[model samples]
Target chain A: MATIKVLAKCCGVSVATVSNILNNKPGASAKTRKLVLEMAEQLNYTPNIVAKNLKMQKTRSIGVIAEDMTIFSIPDIIDGITDYCQKQEYQILLTNLRLFKKYNDTYYNKDDYYELVRQEIKKLMEKQVEGIIYVAAHERVIRCIPDNLPIPAVMAYGYSKSRKIPSVVVDDVGGAAGIVKYLLDQGHKKVGVITGKTDSLHAQARLIGYQQVLYQNKILYDPGLVAEGDWTRESGYRCAGELLEKGVSAIFAMNDLMAGGVYDRVEELKQTIGEEISVAGYDDRELSGYYHPPLTTVSLPLHDIGYKASEWMIELLNGGELENAGENVCAVDCMLLIRKSVKDIT
Target chain B: MATIKVLAKCCGVSVATVSNILNNKPGASAKTRKLVLEMAEQLNYTPNIVAKNLKMQKTRSIGVIAEDMTIFSIPDIIDGITDYCQKQEYQILLTNLRLFKKYNDTYYNKDDYYELVRQEIKKLMEKQVEGIIYVAAHERVIRCIPDNLPIPAVMAYGYSKSRKIPSVVVDDVGGAAGIVKYLLDQGHKKVGVITGKTDSLHAQARLIGYQQVLYQNKILYDPGLVAEGDWTRESGYRCAGELLEKGVSAIFAMNDLMAGGVYDRVEELKQTIGEEISVAGYDDRELSGYYHPPLTTVSLPLHDIGYKASEWMIELLNGGELENAGENVCAVDCMLLIRKSVKDIT
Candidate 1:
């Protein structure tokens, strides 16, 4: 059967008008609404009442706001959100803000790009989206949110500085501390920790967690064991190789991609993971499970974070007071996936 | 000055209503419209005409449709799309069809995952998204696309059976072949290939490219020299180690993650990567440059692929025919990133 979409196009009306008429909503001119019905009838458009109810008070939509859409964590978080929303009959409206880098300073700039994005958001808003989920790619608190939105806003993966919204985040500090403690518990006295960009707030928290864990365990924090990576695999390989040559028994690589690199270089030096030297990684991406020795890594609950973020947004939209003074701070726990990569150094 | 958003909220009317009273759109009831106008003055919500014009009929958004959100490619392509779109004042609306899976009778079941995916797509249609970009976690054609969509759609990191929908894909075959050919040119007779998933279209293409390049140059294809991996660094390490036991002189990993794994295993075996067995990888992820002795890889031009996909979707939306019918393929060239991974066998 032809869909209402075809009917809308044939009659030259927005799908919204066709939906309003089909669902018997209050808006829509009688003339235009009559044309939609006629076209739908001729095309045999089957109206889905289940979808109609889901659409009611909802654009049947949600938005994911993120910087750097390509980060590994995004997909899992999105997967979690999508799975939950779809079960509830909701569609997602994705917004890639790409605010990680400066635009005008780069190569291309076009007016159509700006105009089109604004139009899409306005379109979603006009459809009266029930809730909006902001999926930030990093840990930066956004200060430039558009005030044009009328629906409830929520953050996932990253959050805002203001408490006016709710957010879901991984316990970066707790997760990092767990990794460090894992290394120490395995009896690796000299543990090395690689970090992402020092300026990153999440990275900073991880670093603190690593240090605190070591200090509490009675192991003096060694500056020699600290190195930095750009969150790239090569950086992990290089930094870990440099540290490995110094004879550290266990290594903690931040994020799995970098851990992959460290794993590569460690093997290159004739060291067997979990045998000659123990190694651990973070952000248990799916690929991590397949990595050799299957990378003993930390599993960040990305999907749970996204799901919780959306759930919180729904609550906030309904006028519920989220914790942190209407600013929901959701800290999803991270699990350590023990593969063959770590050794019992004790 | 107060924004129109705050003023409209305070006046208990819609932003569109206030905008209508300001822009003089024809359809508002006179009394309510008058109240909106007077309230805007009292609340000092002097409309920023420039911002308003920017917003007028503009959603400042684009929509992204991905197969699985967590794949390695989607986020990067999104990073590129967002980088470009954000600069143009466009935001991205992200949606994932969650369609990448081995289709079977289970998939066709009404409550099945794939069917649920179609239901989600129907919901995205109701949101009135102006355009859509499809991204896959891996490079290949997806089997779960719904029969119809109401907006312009483009595919990235994947292709469509119908040429009407434009797509952007990397030349995995060519890129993999190029790396193998480089090993051949280096005087290595026993070259091994560490492949990704055996059923993956991209993996099959790379194998074809490897065989084509090797046979054309008069080298024999050995089944013993080929190993299959699911494209993880650990798999690479295992596969490479297996190939090493068989005494292959060089290896070509399907992607960078696998290549890194090969390097790790080689080090563990006390065999140097570049000095003993030459290694190469596809997809010049950031770490390829910083790897010890660096790494030799093929560039996938991910961001470019995303940008071009958007451009193609716009063209299709405007009713333009694809440049070629038989060759509707847009294969991005792979640039050889020569690093320390490969060595001269002669």
Candidate 2:
């Protein structure tokens, strides 16, 4: 349990000297090395292998960096990494920066935590990790990634919201387009959107997709049709209330959580959902399937994406080509799970 | 990208010689080490640090062994571990056993997978993992864990379900007792339960609590009042149907997933939910609050349990006494998020 500092103090040597002896570096004298070793053994010292390995050749591990670690998307991508790594007998180091939780005054700016991330990556680099997987829960035009990363890197669940690097992402535009097209097909002239925080890249992309659909169909776009939520059911409930107050005949919730909120609020209003008002949601989360009058939602094959990213990461780790015929923008087609929520407005 | 063996071949030396030189072991002569080093440098050989570390002392990383990795409970627990370990700067090695997916055959008994588990653990051991977190998604008892583990170990989600080792679990009995008492106070006499997986410890404990409430109230415990599910919505739907067929007025689903299922099924039958048949669920998952008649379910603070478990593990890691202050059974209290899922059935 004793650290190198403690061992160094007990052996009457500098901390760096103790570190050198433990790492088997050339500078330490034989006597000092022997004395440090004996003292370290007596103290039950565990050298920071990760720190020591930085100078040595290999660590047989990779780092996975994610914006939101708790969300479903990160794990789905991790599943891919795990499967692929297991095949080639590799390991992963997972790091999460809770980007949503307010760490500094700047909202969604992970700049304060970038140093911590870089520190871990430095240890990984020290350990000489072979590769890195950068996973972001929501698409963002992040500005702080260091250019000279020490190893091969892959991005998952995000597009370069600003088009900086190649990323693997679901076809949010196509998926959103499909939903709007469906509503139009149902003869809905007044359809509205319940969306997330406005500044987000993921939300913006979805908005773009929705707008493109309306543009393609020659439908007049209305700013009154859009309402922003915090991506929670409560947000959905409040936003849907505001949208309903605007008198839209149909609503498309950007995610399942918001859709669920819409379901509860609509019921409270004594409005017979799907008959009085059509509704749809995204994410197709497991609960969406069983939502009362089950949610008509978009199903992002998160599991498949997770598995694929990890697989590709393994390929990259093995010195395989980073750019593949199927590599960039592997848009996982989102499926529309129809249930009782949407109704024919015609 | 190239391995040590490939480098050795390129350098005209035995793989052992290359490995010895790379590891900085004194066995390799200076001439051989220098030649191997020059060739490795030329070929850009980076030893796998994880692999190299495994060959040395124990990996400071710990393995989190779980039945299924994708579900809500396990992920929360793992996240808790990750959160704590990241603060303490420890690495985790995750192993998803997929135990729910049976690999049974004529040649392999249930214990066969245990051997594979052992082999995997051995790999972790060879990799030098300092400890293990055995996580069970279900309540089925397992007796296959080897007694002579080389490192510290703990169980989660359920009490060992097999051994009497240290464990961290939610207070299922107390939580269930509270829900039943609440339902009883609401004047429900003929209460029913959509029970969890038959093999689960939490399920068993919950059922006992439900029965205890009936006994305390002098209401006869009826066998027809209970139906079983595999802790999924599909199973909840089927179980609710079975229970409804037997005519229970109110139902308490073991978890939120099942409760959501019950809601969907009852709606499918053209019956008004939270009215014709009242229902409740556990876990208080995020979607529960968004249920059409927002689910009145028990909220198990799983993350709290996970955080506490990591705290305990860290304590153990630091040579702190593994003394239980009669707190080995860390029962996280569950809250009933009241919405409109259940109705008072007299």
Candidate 3:
């Protein structure tokens, strides 16, 4: 807790001289600097970082606002960001808004929700964060952006509807298309689909991808072969049961959890996966790799998205020009992890 | 960014008069205070929080070092901490060390591991956190308290080996005993157990609880009926298979993931759970309620632990004496959630 005044008094010099020597500013003689430093060490002087930050106008810290932390994907994304920040010697001020719970509350209207988010941003600003990163709990279009923000901001796992803020998102459509095409190339015909909530943007985009592949293969798109699911294992189970009744040879579930439900139903019917019926899933979650037959699924590059978002924030902080500052949408590719679940019809 | 100096100059008042009036210090007349405040508001002066914190010698912020964020129980604990901090108007500086990965590295010796942890603590200190909370990835005895720590530190979900630091942990033995007693009351005498890694503190404590009940009921302890698992569904599946071969009527898997594996094996062998054989699990994870026949498990009070740990830190900061400061261990009781997984053998 020793201060500059105490060190200066002990070294028989002015406080400014001791401060200059400590800050490595020229003007203090070598002999004087050496004597001041020795006195500081002897006194166990610890500099006040708050004063230093105020003077420099920078804290070397970034604010990360996570919409919710319970979501399985958000943690991995945060891990990626943390890794990058640690290597750069930057600190993170993380605020979990629990927006998922608020969005479900009837008393909190849309305006109230936005107001809550604005309050969170203001709190971070008061902490003097140089930049901010908004992480969405789910992959959806975000419409709320505080007006006239002074600091650099970026979005991850979601984008702003106004297209005025930069974002890093997964190529959901391409991932769906690639997985469906892989199934088609394996000589599978009459493929059934378990779509996510019909209102979901991801669900609609993935459905379009499935239809496009079917059309290119000269196969007629059958609406009866598609059943709607709510991205739950039970929904997947019910939808897969309905699809089985339609006598489809293959089933493409939009997510791995639903695919697990499909597996459960297949086993119930005295049938084996990858043989009696081919199954594929998306979002290659951790459990997918250990699923009974292993799951053939698409891996969402969440880590890369998180890493790239931090990179963009750092770039903006360094006074680098952002390409397409407004309407800037960076899409990362999804990888297909072909495991033991898909049958080799060829 | 208007400074008080600018406001004072614009209002034609001395800086000391403006400062005293703005701070509501005594000796400033009401009329003078009103005039200074009106002028400051008109000038849109925003007080520099950094300077204020420097003068106060406190940041009103706490550092939370999460050993790993991917663990299922961690997010809920963090959510509890965030909820409490938000209510108390305290900011949290979050740092994810990803120590689980580091512990697995062969090159990272004991000293290196502690050094890494010390480095994380130093970073938070640089941020001027008033207190520190260390969140362990799992429940165990920790030995890595940095030497000569200068801040008040607490642990959540783990304890220090020296017992010098306070910790909040679930009553693992009591929770296990309560659930097993419930099973015994249902008239199941021949019970089997699937335990986690023997080296784990939770595993050993839970095992002791299980044996205590058996001894109380005059049922001889049978090591042959116990199978060791690695806390994974696969290990549960394999161990359950071995236990089933011994014709045990009731099985208690130490965790829900392993309980899930037990369910898979039971179905594979064409046996109905909760009827031919009863199954129970611990750590009532998210999917436990959705499992087929639903799982009867022990719910760890993670939220309460988190809330209490923060309460302890805040108390320490308020200069309140920590009860039993060193060797202080606070244990919260776990609740037993009874579902359809346990059968009425009576």
What tens digits encode model 2's per-residue C-alpha lDDT throughout B63-95?
777666665677677777777777776777677
Which candidate, 1 or 2, has the higher TM-score? 2
Q: Which candidate, 1 or 2, has the higher DockQ? A: 1
Evaluation by lDDT, superior candidate among 2 and 3: 3
Q: What is the C-alpha local distance difference test score of candidate 1?
A: 0.72
Question: Which candidate's TM-score is highest?
Answer: 3
Candidate 2 lDDT, tens digit per residue, A305-325? 666777766766676765544
Complex DockQ per candidate:
0.29, 0.13, 0.53
Residues B174-252 of candidate 3 have per-residue lDDT tens digits of: 9989999999999898899999999888999999999998888888999998999999999999999999999899999
The TM-score, computed over Cα atoms with residue i paired to residue i, of candidate 3 is 0.90
Candidate 2 lDDT score at position A85: 71
What lDDT score is found at residue A232 in candidate 3?
92
Taking chain A of candidate 1, what TM-score results?
A: 0.75
The predictions' CA RMSDs to the true structure, in order, are 7.9, 12.2, 3.3
Clashes of 1: 39
Residue B83's lDDT within candidate 2 is 76
Computed on C-alpha atoms, the DockQ of candidate 2 is 0.13
What does the lDDT come to for candidate 2? 0.73
